[model samples]
Target: MVTLGVDGLVSGLDTTSIITNLMSVEAQPQTLLKSQLSATQAKATAYRTVNTRFDAIRSAAEALTSTSLAAARSASSTNSTVTASATSSAVDGSSVSFRVEQLATAKQVTSLEKWSSPTARADEQPKPVWPIKVLDSTGATVGSIVIPANATLTDAVSAINASGYGVHATIVQLAANQFRLQVSSDGTGTDGARTLQGADETADDPQSQTVGTAESGFQRSRDAVNAQISIDGTGYVRESSTNTFADLMTGVSVTVSKADPTATSPTTISVGVDGSAIAAKVKALVDAANGALGVIKGYTVSTAGSAVATLQGDRALVQLGDSVMDAVSSAIGGKSLSTLGLQLNKDGTLSFDSGKFTATLASDPTTVNRLLSGVPATTTDGVTTAAVPGFADKIAALAKAASNSSTGTLVQLANGRDTLANAIQDKIDGWDIRLANRKDTLTKQFTALETALSTIKNQASWLSSQINQLYNPNKSS
Candidate 1:
């Protein structure tokens, strides 16, 4: 057996192992730095999310400043319900009549007139004749004619048109096929009505019996009705002709053209207003203050022994909530509901005093507007930007200071939230890039160390083999 002491080679392997261990140990600081970077990035992301949500609450609080619930709900149209009367009447000279009914009822009306078959009124006897005369321009005696009773008006018009007279005749259909004839002068003042002959008997000679003129008597009338309604206990009159109401409140319109007056009872219509739709548009100087107070309160909450403490104590969330709520709470104009005939409850709901509201409205509506619009009177020391924490001034400053697309205070808040989120993301991206570079460097160094260890192991093995061959005396022989 060839004796070979392997302590040296084993020691070399141990040394290589020690170098690999040292590499791993040296990379620990890099790993720790990466973990710290990751934690910082996560914190930034969390804060950004909080900032975005904080702004949303601000918007929701602002929506509460819309027109009062009653004002919004009162916006609607008026309806009409009228009953017509059924009776016959004459329309003589200049006479007009309108029908009226109970405010919520419908009425029906009708009229009538009569005519003989052709030329006589309904009261005329059979074989009767109508008086008609013909005259020249000089009023000279020309002719006379008679139209027999029981003749249809249509036949009389046709006969007159066919006659070789200086006048033309036409029938007017007053209703379905009901006829009445009208005559007109065919020539200028003197030439017209000069061709009529005369009628001395029931069967007059056609040559000289034509009438110089025609006469008829007719009249008709029908009844019309309207409805009346009382709004807020005050009577409001409306015509049955149209159904529309305007400007019950600002930014509101209503139309009511349809109603069933024949129904036993009146129908009630409903209208609703969406406060949330306009919430963000309201000024919220007061809300911001209260929200900030809440944040301060929440931060002081203590966790019990068994319960885990929440991260709600973060100073950023506290400051953000305080900033938004305080801004709204300290806004100018009427901050409390009492100024507008409404009372705020502890739970944040408003109670309306209808009588007081109406009285105040009746006396002065400008006050109401001032109370709602946040436009403070000169006597009132309006809210200042400082009262709302730094929010009001900050937002105004941001709006004026920002050169971006956002110009309004609300837009500034949104832009700020976006900027915060982007900042957090940028930090994360930067950290990721740094970690990736560090990881790459560490990987390359470790790979090189592994290659060096392998080369040294191979060289040690070859040297040991050469030493064994050189010392082998039998192999040389």
Candidate 2:
């Protein structure tokens, strides 16, 4: 992309200035193209800004229609020992109490006699045969591990660990060189109790690994026990394999951490709807509406003596704020939005009164939810009417229509502006090439003229010299 603008060589003319002026005149169309591109880009940016606000409004408005907000609930316990949680299906005003009688216990046991070596040595023990079987409380063989024959205590621990049917075993050191086998259940339930079936032992046989039943002299450290709880001071007891009780009440889960066998004073449990949460969501919608209106005003509003805006007099964006206002300003079930603490201001923005809204929600929560979303069909007097959409529904649909990526009005408008800007830039680029070519042609023409003029001047000087020499030749002779 080289360019040349040379001065006159022989004609003494300013070729550079001449070519520059001509190119300036020829580039007028490109100047106009650049101006158009800048305008189109500004308009596209304005559209994107408005579209972003519209999307935010859509999200906030749609949130008010969520069922979770309509009946959002929370649960609490009076005592830390008894914690509770409520689900979506939980009733709003249900209260229940439970007295934890006993906590579930896992089966734990230890061998009575210490393992000792057959050499009567102080620091060794006899190794047992392979495949020691373990049985649960119901006498069902849970697992059998074929460990290496003549296994060590650690090897025996590994063998018991390999028996993966809810049994874990470890070696306990009671004193110097005095070790015993301790086995515990992995789960807390009466059904999870385990018995280590091993070689029988007699007093005469010190090395015989007798690890069967209590007859084999084993101490039960803790028995596998079920959790027990009484409901509302009832004498009847409810048993559970685990501490967590999910079926005690509808949509309620209670987990007990301590036991109070005497049902004297029980922990209180309460469940209720979240009023503040609902109010906050409503406030969010109002704030989002305000934001959208603010963006629109910034783009459309102009004072009497102020400069024009990028999107001034834009009908689509001008009507956007009004449309959203109209969608949300309508009454719900014969009640105006003012009653719900969402007010339309004189400047066409939304203002929220959180205190008043929360008060209204506290008094008539059902109506509040209905105003935000919509209620089911109702028959009044004698006419049956279908369900009516509410402010949230209307605003959500409107904002979605204006901001949806595939078919949104502002999105497509911005895209069109971008396309037009790109086309204008293309034309400007073409004009640039044309102007450069024109400058190069002018420079070549000037250079060629300078060469021709120099040749004619040389020929004229030679002719004058020849005439002088010929005329003065006789005089010289």
Candidate 3:
């Protein structure tokens, strides 16, 4: 069908402008639906943002309520030569004094004879048997290496290194065309010494001389010794294979870097509660809570001439904020959050007073701990009363409830909004089809009207012409 326009040829009417005006009026409802859909999408995005904040707050709360918080300990050593570290299992407020008598040493050995050159031509050098035997501190033949005939000194060094006897071998060049093979124990201890000998010719003792060329004879270079330390005066002495002493004390490890047997002073190792660290963790919890509250406030605020708040008049967000505030204000161990330096502000968020918190920690740290993490309540009667939940516990529970995917408030609200928006979009689509059909019908009707008017005008003009011809026929002759 032809589309009617402003210049109707025979009807002399502005049909195009009229149809456009009517279509504009018909599209009002669809425009409103689209606006509502945009607002719903924005609201869903806002809810997701708030949900992320809630997750952060939840994690912070979990950290505050963990057992590690209460068991935290820090260790310090008075002497720089001594390094100490403690775990959560370490006893708090425990101190020990110890004197370093000796540090553990590793055993090393070097070839008794020096070679002319390490990288000399292998075929020119006198090679030992097919393989050489390596022995441990116990004089047992532990491993063997193959020194192929006519191989260089570097090859011998590589073979000795490949022998799995807990020893490392290297070629030490002394001067031009002069090198010595040195082997050392991989571990520091009296039991870590190693020896090398000819294959199938080892004596019963490690110190026994072996039959080989002067260049292949191994001699002791360094002696291995165990570490010795005296703790709490000379009454208690501890011995270790390595410089690091772990079993001397529970949950504490001390590494001895140097020996000072003649020194009159002993290194003091102090183990105590890490109050500042614990306080900082509590402050983190407060900060996270405030951040969550700030997000809620930002998305719910309604300012004049400003963009509409996505979560404006959202009861779920309002209730969530209120719940968090309630948790903060809740009493733990009969003490309010203000007592712990977490003060509530007028804008429904928390502010941490570092000075006050530090003072509280300095004065009575146990009280602060008990307040943040409550103890088991004493029962007065046989009907046992439940333990009081701490601020962190309450906050964690609230956040968990709000962020639960299956039944969370934000999730449910977002789902509901999505459903409504989809339904509205379906309605808008239907209206699109209906409006197109209506416009097509109108265009067809106007086209038909124009065709009828054109036919009538042509008939009227023909009749007038015929009547003139009939009346003026005699004049024409």
Candidate 4:
């Protein structure tokens, strides 16, 4: 029969194994929670990075707004030179003139190559001529024309205009019946190729004309105004085109050319912040941020295909997502993005009412600028104030808010998470400590039980031997 000690030994071993396994099951949640918290922190960091880029681009755009450049034109008659004066609000408002010895000019052609052959419909009578394509110095097709055999210059102009390939045909009457064909460009940029084909009724068959580019009046030369500048009462000599004048003045681009031999004309082309472009850039950034925010706000578990396993309904995630929206909405300037004419759409995109925005800017540029720079926390004198009132202040606040260090939300989340993690860690630590102790205790109990069992068994053996010897009679002595 089994002894009590043996039965106890079997029970202790089974209990130890079961308890250890139960402890592991209880610790599972803490491990998973730590990972979730880490993911939340990562998402926050990504949002902050995108937010920072938006702020940077917006600031750059704003600074460029309202800046303007002015230029003065002058030309020298004696030297065929041109000069211009460039100035800006920030630069010294003083005018400086320089001598331009030469004006930028390009070669122009009085006539484009005529197409010896004309394309005719099948129903039309056969015309034994081919159309020619005209090219400029760069071998680009500037125009094309068709001519009947031995056609006069008068006939050529009429034919070119009728072709409708964009080149204008004009005949200059210099001498009696001495007509020169003039072909002008239809658009900007360098001229293109002029080619001839088919037969000229009176001459040899028309071969392709050698492509030639006429010189343009525009030249690459120094600005006559700054050709010589008295910098601190000293003169600086310059050559070439007025683009050099651009280098002298901040934000001024001058086209230098000869107005006449006696005067060098420098025209200062105004270069200012394209308000439209700046506004567009601002709208794009806001739109992008809104897209991301909208997606997060409307996140649905239905998209995940398993309602029971969805993270969309998680309270922690929802709270975190709301915080992200609040941060952005609160950071933007004025009453809201909507107040600035940026409206959100259902598909998570933003559209700017350009007409409304333009009207606001035109009516009060400064007010618009200030609105763009700040958040609307309150209203005063019929104007909404920003949550962060000034451009400089807004930038500083955003920087502070986005910091991942001790004072930032990231740090707070991390610390809070660490607190939760530490709690779980503490539990795990306690479990480890308990496990060690339990394991040690079980080892001792098992060892003690085994020793007792051995002793009992030995005692039983001795008792049985004595019983048998006594029962055998002669064997007992």
Q: TM-score for all predictions? A: 0.34, 0.69, 0.72, 0.43
Candidates in order have lDDT scores of: 0.40, 0.77, 0.78, 0.45
How much does each candidate deviate from the true structure in C-alpha RMSD? 20.3, 7.3, 6.0, 17.2
Tell me, by TM-score, which candidate is best: 3
- Badly placed stretches (over 4 Å) of model 1 are 1-477
Compose the digit string of candidate 3's lDDT tens values, residues 292-392: 88889889988899986778867889889989888877777678889878877887878888778778876887777667766666778677777877777
Candidate 2, residue 285: CA error in Å? 1.6
**What are the per-model numbers of colliding residue pairs?**
39, 0, 0, 66
As a TM-score, model 2 comes out at 0.69
On residues 294-321, what C-alpha lDDT tens digit does candidate 2 reach at each position? Answer: 8888888786888778888899997788
By TM-score, the better pick of 2 and 3 is 3
What are the runs in model 4 whose C-alpha is more than 4 Å off? 1-246, 253-268, 291-341, 347-349, 352-371, 374-411, 473-477
What pairs collide in candidate 3? none
Task: In model 3, state the lDDT of residue 391.
Answer: 77
**Per-residue lDDT over 1-477 for candidate 1, one digit per residue giving the tens place of the 0 to 100 score:** 121222124234443354446656655655665565554444444443444434544444333332332233222122343221111121112111112223222211111232433444522422113443544444554444444565455555555555544445554557653544444434332233333322322223347865332221212121222333333323444343223323222333334434443444443333333222222223243343344345334443445653322334655455544443333344334344454445434643334455565565546655544454443223336645422212233433322332123453334544554565566556656766765565556555555555676788899999999999999888956
- State the lDDT at 121 in candidate 3: 43
Better candidate number, 1 or 4, judged by lDDT: 4
